[model samples]
Target: MQKKLIDDSFSIVLGKQGLDLAKILDEKKYINEFIIAKKMNLTINQVRNFLYRLFEHGLVSNIRKKDKKKGWYTYFWKIEKINTLEFLDKEIKKRIYNLEHLLKSRETKRFYTCERCNIDYSEENALLNNFICHDCESVLVLKDNTKEINEIKKNIIYLKKELEEVEEEIKKNKDFLLKKREREIKKEKRLKKQAKEKLKKKKINEKKKIKKKTKKIKSIKRK
Candidate 1:
């Protein structure tokens, strides 16, 4: 379900082709462009273009490495899952805000429409025009807000739910990253402690060897 949401979000940003790329790129690993191209049956340049588009939106990340023998660079790409999800979340919020504003306007304001001309006007505009259609010369009818209001309300509800899910996914990603970082830090500290102990042992062994050599030298002199 999370994968579907992520894919749907990517598709919204990158179009239908974005869904294919989403499947090809891994969030955990950077994949070679050539490999991605092969999997998608696209040219390397085409793959780069798609990845670059994603890069422009900060949805994807890339790393380039120079080939040792060829001296040319190869690009590897990966999806920024958290960034993508957050982007969708912001978009959803914006839409919901706009829809709520429209809903309020629909509820509070009066609107008229000319059935003949199929043009709508607010009460202010209808009064300005004497409540008549300028082109058709017919009296305007009061517009019904029920359908439009219900539709907007439904959209707002759906977006709010989607926003909640996206936020949940973002939190999960953050927690996973935090735990991974903690493990890496613990491993680094353990390695550093071992290195310090090994160095201390080496110094003590050197000191013992020097003391033994000094005793032998004194004994030789006495003999």
Candidate 2:
């Protein structure tokens, strides 16, 4: 499901030319940028352009590694899964807002259409055009709100459904991120505790050695 969302996300963002870039990034951590270029069969610069776009969006991250052989720094890249999900969620919410605005306008305002040309125009635009079809030279028809409104309303419903699913994915990704953070926190705590315990044992051993030496010295004095 996550991969599906990732794929869906890239497809949406890249339109007709992109694939599952998130999956490609996720499969290898800190992957060399050149490797991505090779796999995509795109020029290095093209891949860099796309990756930079994702970087600006905060959907991908990178680290630079100096090439031992070439004496130049090269970057490695990976997807920021949580950020990608959040980005998609934000986009969906924006669309939903636009849809709601359209729905309200459709419910409350007037619209006109050119029936013979099957062209749609806003009421203000139609009025500005003098309610005449520019192409057919026919008078504009007062659009019936019933059929088109129903279709728009249905589209709004579908968009809302998709928005909810995107929200759900965001929630799931957030939980995963939180859990990952917690695990790292716990691991650090555990390592710190072990270090403290080791120090405590060393102190105790040192104290024992001191007491044994004092006893031996006192015994030698008494003898």
Candidate 3:
């Protein structure tokens, strides 16, 4: 589900080209741009163009490494998963809001349509024209908005549900990242503790060796 949303968000931002690039991008690690181009069967410039578009939207991030031998810099790209999800969330909310607004308009306002010409007009326009079709010169009938209103309502419901799922996915990803950070911290602490212990043991062993050498010299002088 998360993948689907990510793909959709990419497609929305960068179209089909973005979707193709997104398929090869990594969530955790950065991938070489050349490899991405190869996988997508596109030129490096084409891949960069798509990536730059995503970058403009904060959907992807990049790092550059300079090659001493080649005297050039290469970029690696990774998907910003959380940002992508957030973008999708905002987009879905906007869509839902617009759908609700349209639904309200349909329920409240009157619409007139010319059946022959298949043209529609608002209440004010229809009133100004005396409820007559401007093109077909036929009497304009009041359009039943029930079907349109219901469709808008259904779309709103679907978008709301999708928003809920996106929010949940965002929460889960955040939790997973937090847990991963915690594990990394603990591992670092453990490694530091082990290093300290090893150093302490090494010092103790060195001290013991010095003491043994001193005792040997004293016994030799007494003998």
lDDT of 1 by residue, 119-218 (tens): 9999999999999999998999999989999999999999898889999989999999999999999999999999999999999999999999999999
Best by TM-score: 1
Q: Enumerate residue pairs that collide in model 3.
A: none
Model 1's lDDT to the true fold? 0.91
**Better candidate by lDDT, 1 or 3:** 3
Candidate 1: where is the Cα deviation over 4 Å? 38-45, 67-72, 116-118, 134-138
Clashing pairs in 2: none
What value of lDDT does candidate 3 attain over all alpha carbons? 0.93
Quick one: RMSD of model 3? 2.5
lDDT, each prediction? 0.91, 0.80, 0.93
* Steric clash pairs (candidate 1): none
- Highest lDDT: which candidate? 3
Across residues 1-223, which tens digit of lDDT does each residue of candidate 2 receive?
A: 6776666666666753446466567734799888888888888898888888778878778999898999998889987777777777777777778877887898898888999999877899899999999899789988888876788778878867776877787788788779999999999999999999999999999999999999999999999
**Pairing residues by index, what is the TM-score of model 3?**
0.85
